[model samples]
Target: MASIAIAQTQQAQATTSAPSAAAAAAPAMQLEPTSVIVLDSGGGSIKAGWAHDSQPTIMGNCITRPRSARRTFVGNELDQWGDLSGLYYGYPTQKGFIVNWELQNKIWDHVLSSSVLEVNNFAETSLVLTEPLFNFPAIQSAMREVAFEEHGFQSLLHTTAPELSAYQQRVDSPSAQEAQVVVDSGFSSTYVVPFVQGQMLPSCATRIDVGGKVLTNYLKDVLSYRQINLMEETHVVNEMKEKACYVATDLQHELEKAKQRPSSNTISVDYVLPDYTTIMKGFVRAPVARTGPANMSSDEQLVKLNNERFSVPELLFHPSDVGIKQTGIPELIGLVVESLEEAAQYYAYQNVVLTGGNARFSGFQARM
Candidate 1:
């Protein structure tokens, strides 16, 4: 997911450094480093920073109440927590829309507080916040109200994540200046959003209910059924998915290889789960060349993983595998592009940018 997000920025950088005809037409003017805060609040995390100056401060976007820790982790505070096992999660957003202002306000306070950003006041700076595609009108205005009425920001620009991504790509290159398609695989849901010349084409936007959180939950269920019950260990499960999962370029071929001789198959790996006593983190080790049953270290527990690794990530491409009955990511993206005029379709295809956490999976770019 981090790789894909960085790729999008790099794509923009290449164009920004050497402006093409379309990009040259409207050059970006330099502004004060702290003039505008480009805030991207996704279902899974928040990415916020001063535009054109620094990288965004990233933090988990949800609230957690851990049984062991017995303390509430609001937003980025979870990063400081030690044990995350058997934690109850509280989401401020439902289906990609912010529904709980009270809880979310707590996070915004932390983000904007003097101890964090050192911003004494927001009235002097403009706030640019990214909202989900096809946002509810009430939620949309409510965000603006909070920024102005609650936070006292001088100005507010409420835009969608896909639009910001498209605009960023467009400002650097002429490729994204026309109709461009953006696929944001976020925590709450994946969205197929179209933008024309930096403006969102709401008519061409679509949503897929599957997302990172869903995939993590699904993996937890499958692993519990097939191996161990990791249903309540969300933090550990999420970490496992991030480290072990990858989208398969050829699903059938990979599945077949996993069934073949275990010694030579490339689809197999051994994940060492943390004991939380001697070892604090889990990691995958390179396959050992063995002639018989695998050997385990006395002090460590190793879980042999095969198809489950790719199969979980494959849910993004084939939601039907889990009975969601939706078109795959690429097919859905193609459909959205085909809906545009023939001329725009070419531009849309050429400038399709993938953003959000799910895009970081290995072979994700190749599969799409």
Candidate 2:
């Protein structure tokens, strides 16, 4: 599971770097050339644009939470007050739902009015924004209000991020019988979606409270346990995970190697922090060092790559370890298949398809 996520992350990076490639490959997905805008606003970031395109046209997190409303974007310009403050500083749909009308209004205002976008003529734009699966009706109503009334957006198509991504993947796949599962590992949670014959099985869908943010926090805790004072070093820790972390195929065997003396098989890392050239790159010494705390001595410590961080994320597979009584994924899949009463037409064993950001994880493919 971790491997696939890493691959997806790398692919996302590649897509961002190569816009022309994305644009050229857009038509293969059979998406309508209606200036389609697919928007995904999670708890951590926002991804917005056409579904067929290789990437979002504009990708930027609404960083308003960390800044005051008066903080002007146009140079530290003076003469800022209340009403203008709210207008200038774009709003965000924090806590993973678009509940506040004012914030949604601000978001629409920013997206439409930004100098980078000339989308004032909303009728020409086929807008697609993300919404949670079990989204509250009030929030849905508010979003509709914002689209039609506030933004004058006539063609609004709201879908969940996972669902739309699933749609794209399903459409892209070779045949309709390719049974695939869509796992979305986002900011606040992870969703495992089962698709058979291009349709999603809602009851079989499962969620885990694990994500990049959760893994980051877990790594933070492990480093803290090692007495690493990282009150201001969150970014460094994140970089380390991105560079060095990997899930062990055989946990016990890897743990044994990590138990060996540092000179033998252990990973020795030299985190060269912050000279500010693309964030400090962490290097793992070829001939491992016999240094640092005794607690960091075990092979298990280094073998897992993420230490407890990897295990904590793995808890999604074994929720019982974390006190969640829900069945793990394989069992869940079986249950889901059983529950699909219309299974005569579809073969769960043969046509299983797995696609999604989270579905890219290392062990995910094999496990499914």
Candidate 3:
């Protein structure tokens, strides 16, 4: 929370400094991004911001929950921003895209009602709202209607966040004028978008619905299967993944090392189980007495078990092992390149820029 607060403060400071800096340096500056908006409607987050900035000003979703001031629907109401109630809160997107209309409207309403968006401040602003590629016409029409009729904005524009990231990269690298591949590993899915001279290659661009959520769920399942019993409790399992889990470069070799005897290789984790007793963590089908003498084989089994938990998440890269036919990041990148015109593949590679939450996965960029 402190880190978030600090970052927000820095962003506020930057926002204030930009206008003054621009005014002081006006003579040298020609055309600037000046007034632009960018929106990313990924599964887990809905981020809106000015284009020249690296971060978002407004980030929320269509999901609602019981908040402090309200019984339900905290996300829709603006009055409860600082005093959000302690109830269920969530975004409208389920897998990666918007499915619920009421929730979407509520989120949009809350955004418009924000103090930053007050009528006196930004009435004639240029707006940009992102949508999924090949978005349904009905959703598009509804979006347009809401922005024009409800918000009363003068200018409106639409584009994909991944495309904009690609544009930013292209602008930075002028030589990337050929076919390009963009891998947007966002919250909902990893999208492989191929482009030829800035035009989308609709047929070759594919979306795979495996991502962070899948990784978390997979970790939960592995821990549960090892008798850790995380089904009723996800907090510790989530913590273990966030704090300890890592993808191994070589699975078989790592497994062999993890199978070693527990003298120097294994360490115990103290967990207060449902019974509220501090017990050393190990791989056991049933909980053993913490007060009892330590056993050697049990410790070895525990180490192997933890290794399996760590390795299982690697299945996302090669889903064929689990019978899912979706392509992984590197394969998808090649596919995107292939889908473009023959001359454009190299250009696309040079301009390929990755964005979205999933891009932060360890080794994701290297693998791509």
Best by lDDT: 1
> Please, what are the lDDT tens digits per residue for candidate 2 over residues 218-309?
66676667655544444456555555555555667666776665556553444433333333234443333545354342322232232452
Better of 2 and 3 by lDDT: 3
lDDT of each: 0.74, 0.50, 0.53
Show where candidate 1 strays beyond 4 Å.
1-31, 287-296
Rank the models by TM-score, top first: 1, 3, 2
* Candidate 2 colliding pairs, count: 16
**True-structure lDDT of candidate 3:** 0.53
All candidates: CA RMSD (Å): 4.4, 8.4, 8.8
Candidate 3 TM-score versus the reference:
0.70
What is the C-alpha local distance difference test score of candidate 2?
Answer: 0.50
User: Residues 94-185, candidate 1, lDDT per residue (tens digit)?
Assistant: 88778888988888888887635656767787776778777788988899889999989876666666666666667656867777778888
Across 254-278, the per-residue lDDT of candidate 3 in tens digits comes to 6776666554334223232322122
